[model samples]
Target: MKKTISREALKSASLEYNDVSGDFNWIKKRRGPIKVGQKAGSINHAGYVVIKIDQMKFMAHVLVWFLKTGEWPTLDIDHINGIKTDNRFQNLRHVTRSVNLQNQRKAHPNNHTGLIGVNKKGPKRFLALIQIDGIQKSVGTFENAIDAHNAYIEAKRKGHPGNTL
Candidate 1:
């Protein structure tokens, strides 16, 4: 189970907030004997920051939302820039999983076609596809990857609002 902190409890924790970095430094050590004003938590293997409060561990992004809003986020906290470690308050927003996925980076590690949604269909043919609401729709096949990608982008713009190529 995930641990959530209330705004009052967070205030009681005596953490100092860095306006520039949007990170909370522990001013008062709760259970651990650590120096005051030291940056709290460490980046986990998944790249998200984790802070330990008492015996419970919480994600720093979620904690930041609670601190700023005085309420827990009912939906996922998405990093607007798509960088996991950039926890600046301005870079964060509460969004649904689908909307969050729409704002993701264009290419993944396995992308070899150099364009998002464009893949090699054959030696000389490229296929463009887009997924909307968990359903994959084919844009069209093209002789060049760029053309296929263009079709994919057009389809994406029409299907998704506020989407950027």
Candidate 2:
């Protein structure tokens, strides 16, 4: 199993965090292509930044949270703008897993309507659905997808964990 990393360990390591820009710079040279003062992370397969320290891989956003606050996050870190690689301190929020999922910037790939929670109900109506406390609640039918989406956003504003609206 991989060992759990601590904030103090990262603070003493070779990385220097740039909170405003969300960039990590190498503070010292290391073996095999790593150089002093170079950017210290790469875009991972999921589009988030990942950096390797002492053979252990860590998400750059997590590192930023750790370094900036001096406390490892106990919950999910959300990128408010939906760009996973953008880890600027102001863009990051420490939230619950539900809130993290709710703040997504894009509709699901399988969503045919191109708007989150809005689906075609019939020939001239749309359905709006939202998740609240693990329940999929229907908001109501609407004439257009935008209206349905607005209903969903309104429901989210009420109490949905994401509250990104």
Top candidate by TM-score: 2
Candidate 2 minimal-lDDT segment of 10 residues: 1-10
Worst 10 residues of 1 by lDDT: 156-165
* Model 2: residues with Cα > 4 Å off, grouped in runs: 1-3
Candidate-wise lDDT, in order? 0.81, 0.84
Give the per-residue lDDT digits (tens) of candidate 2, residues 18-114: 8767899999888889889999889988899998877788998888887778777888988888889888999888998878887765688999899
Score residue 156 of candidate 1 by CA lDDT. 89
- Candidate 1 contains a number of clashing pairs equal to 0
lDDT score at residue 110, model 2, on the 0-100 scale: 94
lDDT of 1 at 159: 82
